[model samples]
Target: MNIRHYFDLCVEAGGQVFERIGLTDDYRASRGTGFFTAEHHIRYYAETRVGEEVSVYVRGVDRSDKVVHMVALLVNDTTRRLSCTLEIAAIHVDLRTRSAAPFAADVATAIDRELAADTADWPVPVCGAMGIRR
Candidate 1:
């Protein structure tokens, strides 16, 4: 298994869940912008072997108009344990300007809904120095 693929999977899963308003292809195309990962931290709790069945669960944790916090869990189904957790902070970007940009109204509303609806049983493992820049 490509371990790094987990991060990509997490991003893809999040994009799909928020595709209606969060960083969708239409948004990128129409707005000429997209989301860029600003920070990433992973905490490993257990080893997930190649043959082990693992599920990737990703959810929004919080958001601002320009940034969003998300967490992804890699669960070892065979062992019924969490293999790892990924914390990601991503920013909306302007493709043309190459700078942070605010999300559209609909996107912000969708992010708000996701943040409100998302829940977790465990605390997210985050690095001390990473987050949306003030």
Candidate 2:
């Protein structure tokens, strides 16, 4: 799959999480710019063919007042193999000031709850500082 397709999967899965915390419509309506990606990383393990059954597994890796980080694993269902992994750090922002904005108390609390629940069953380690030596 292309890079955009991978990103789309991440967004869709992340949206579900946000929706549960009551940040869906509000986030969408803030079209002017509500959030920005601070970092995004992807690692590929295998290729997936068209029409193949697959699943995207999302986990909340970490979060703060204005930032949330997540990891998503794309797996081939039939073979039960990993296809790729995506890590993203997104920050809430204020469009007018183009600056970070803290999430609401409820939103922050909800995120913490989600993180705890998701972390309990996390399947993969959320990697950091990836690279290779020649």
Candidate 3:
């Protein structure tokens, strides 16, 4: 599976949830121009195939000034495996002055709520569990 596709899926899924809860206007509007900056890091620990149903669960969100940081986990249903984990940091800024905007309280709340909901039952096997000849 392509890692970029997985990352895009997570971003799109998270953006939808955020919009549903009125976190930001829209992802496109929030991008570039210093309005919003997202630095995403994804780690793929296991192999995943096509046609597998996956779900992205937000784990946490943090805000400092205009920056909003989010952590999320992606799980595959077929194998009940964690396909990848992502950490994203987004900054909110003013389009006009190119300065930081006051952190939106609603955005923060929505992010936290999403993360809490998805992290309920996380199952990832430890490295020791995978059998390998020493």
Best by TM-score: 1
Residue 58's lDDT in candidate 1: 76
lDDT of 2 by residue, 4-99 (tens): 876687678777777886676666476433668787788888887667888987888778788888888888887779888888788878777889
Quote the positional error of residue 94 for candidate 3 in Å. Answer: 1.0
Q: Pairing residues by index, what is the TM-score of model 3?
A: 0.68
- Candidate 1 — which residues are off by over 4 angstroms? 18-22
TM-score per candidate: 0.84, 0.82, 0.68
Q: Over the stretch 23-120, how does candidate 1's per-residue lDDT look in tens digits?
A: 66777888898988888887778887778887887777678779988887888899999888788888889999989998878778877887777566
Give lDDT: candidate 3, residue 3: 82
- Candidate 2 residue runs with Cα over 4 Å from true position: 27-33, 119-123, 130-134
Quick one: best lDDT, which candidate? 1
lDDT of 3 by residue, 10-104 (tens): 78776766566565555436643333545666778677788988887764444555665665678898899988876666666767777767645
lDDT of 2 at 7: 67
Worst 10 residues of 1 by lDDT: 1-10
Task: State the displacement of the C-alpha of residue 34, model 3, in Å, after optimal TM-score superposition.
Answer: 8.2
